[model samples]
Target chain A: MNLVANFGPGRPRVEQRRRRGQTPRAEILDAAGELFTTNGYANTSTRVVADAVGIRQASLYHHFAAKDDILDALLVETIAAPLELAERLRDVREPTPARLYALAWFDVRQLCAARWNLGALYLLPELRTERFAAFRLRRDELRGHYETLAAAVLAEAGGAGIVGAAALPFRLVEMVINMRSDEGSAPVFAERTIPEAALRVLGWPGDLDALRGRAQLLLAQLEPA
Target chain B: MNLVANFGPGRPRVEQRRRRGQTPRAEILDAAGELFTTNGYANTSTRVVADAVGIRQASLYHHFAAKDDILDALLVETIAAPLELAERLRDVREPTPARLYALAWFDVRQLCAARWNLGALYLLPELRTERFAAFRLRRDELRGHYETLAAAVLAEAGGAGIVGAAALPFRLVEMVINMRSDEGSAPVFAERTIPEAALRVLGWPGDLDALRGRAQLLLAQLEPA
Candidate 1:
């Protein structure tokens, strides 16, 4: 094991110094996420990301082969935690409304709290391309989880007959992206309001206060210590 | 008037032939709309738009001074009708819920029925710059209208103290943009469900069926012949 590995296969690679992340890859993603979100993804270039990261272009290529790979990594990072939570929530034996609320709450909080508005990337026309198919598939799976939870909530609320009601909870959580876009910040009321609104739209007849308590408890129990 | 006026300041400008619209400007907008919505705004150039319209780049300049101008025109067009309707609905004698419902229904229908998904452009980071301030202000005005109507609906529904309940209806209607983004079409349930959901999230306790009837009548009265 070499004590000092160069950043990449280039002449005189600079040491990774004072970037936000623990490693070169994290530093690159940090720069790319900022540039992509604020400067527009289509408009950002690898050179620019490298410049931002204080890395040479060849060094960036060493870590990620292309701009798409960097973007894919960032996109995947945004969804991975929530998707894991959603998957874990599936195995938890709780009321459907509480489960649904926890999912929306946790998802909205992340969307709101991320360092950059990476959720905004979901609107990129580039996402329609096959290059991002895996990211798209993962997003679909997450949406499926939200829909299943929503459907169960509707059934419990006697609204199973309401066609398309299941679709709104996922859409409601996603609305945080737009909300952040408009307000230039995490919407102040998002965590408190969106989860409740998601249930309300599904015709969940339970008191939101009680549902909030149960959902909070579920999230605490499931969250890693 | 000259019968054979040149399309622009250049030798042998081609006459406007069969395009989507009667005039060259409209035709240019039609083509740009398609290209911007399908390909993307940043990815498209005025030259590409000119080629799509089967015109010279100089002629395209005669119609739109810059690509930003074309986008500004499109952005303004998307909000103009709905803003007008929202303004007019303010004067109509109907319950607040019905008026709000009509505004949402009309907005959702336009978003869903447009020849292109221009609403998707609203998320463009370019809009954050000063160049698009007018369009942004108009959208804020539209949101303000929704919030005002929503607040009234809540007041009547006994949830007046519910902070931020008014914000969700506008956000809910805007979700149609995201739905279209994911699904690659106007979501089938958007026009029918979004308007109702907007009211439902606001704690509207009235029968949706009854509100729908009044809102429909209100729209019929306000719409131009």
Candidate 2:
């Protein structure tokens, strides 16, 4: 079965330091990230990860204490960056519509920028494992961020409390995570498209241009001063 | 790792026929479905499936030529049901709004009624295997069904053409597939909930009560008369 192909016999080869600037640790993370996305976290093994990175299995551990540590490093960049952005946007002066726009705008841009469908990792039931607990907490907090913003948009639109209202925009933006592999859309358009559709889903009847503009303004403030 | 824990070992046992009247074939399917949902399909083996059904491993082959066939059967009921309903809706006399509502209403209901999250199987990369080719075709056709309806909704909404329109509603209804286990929301409410949210996502500004009523009326004709 292709399921067990990762376990094939080998004394894994070591890398020759092919990349100019990246540390071996970073390279291991890159290779593991690709395999984890393609072969699945469950089906892939330490040996398979070593083989993919062109490193000896023993050398792989020198960088990561374990497989999950590599996964955690990825989460720090992939999942945590947006959480930081969401935290910053919560303090903005504009009302709910602008806050929701900013969140979806950058969030979709991040998803489009990722090298693989990271949502595949998010969907795995194996994520409930204790190894991923830290990542899970940040992920849940990001979810809470969306819910708070979505709730405001609903209320702003006079759309009153509704089941899954908070969840609607979150799922809409998450559609980016699940989009087809060959998707050729520009991230610029996706920034506007998803959050705007989200406003529609919230029954928001505000000016789209104004809301999108606020998101861009807010995005600028998020960068280093 | 808990990742592979689903593939347990067992000698197997015989069923007592706990239910009043399920045939052995039907019983095997029920057990396999439960295990597949509880455990990843790649992690589940013939022995584990047989033990779940209280049957000998050799006996499982009598009913299902192999494990994938059992999976194929579940797809027929869980995924194929919506496809069939969409086919029936195609022949009905209604606007695209009513047709999309009919599709989502029944689809969300069928999802809530199913005992397991079958969409998890649909997400597996292994689904691209040759055996699943037929299922993939039907699944793609269902996607086409959503895009056509979504395009009409977007045109009606005066919304600009952009990224991810067709995927928005499919992912929205598929949220039912990803909902948390503790969720006890009324399915009766979901019948209205998902479709209406989808119209909002499509930016449909039509009177919802009237549209929902028409969807319900068209739903009656979907029965195999």
lDDT of 1 at B127: 89
What are the runs in model 2 whose C-alpha is more than 4 Å off? Answer: A1-21, A160-163, A181-189, A223-225, B1-14, B18-21, B158-164, B181-190, B223-225
Span of ten consecutive residues with least summed lDDT in model 1 chain A: A1-10
TM-score of each: 0.93, 0.85
Candidate 1 lDDT over residue span A1-225, tens digit each? 223334565445455463588777898999999898888888999999988877778889988999999999999988898899998899988888899999899999988888888888887888999999989999999999999998888888886223577889888888888888888885688897889888888887678888889999999988532
Model 1, runs deviating above 4 Å: A1-18, A160-162, B1-19, B160-162
For residue B97, model 2's alpha carbon misses the true position, in angstroms, by 1.1
Query: Who wins the lDDT comparison?
Result: 1
Clashing pairs in model 2, backbone N/Cα/C closer than 3 A? B13-B54
Clashing pairs in 1: none
- Candidate closest to the true structure, highest TM-score: 1
Real contacts retained, model 2: 0.24
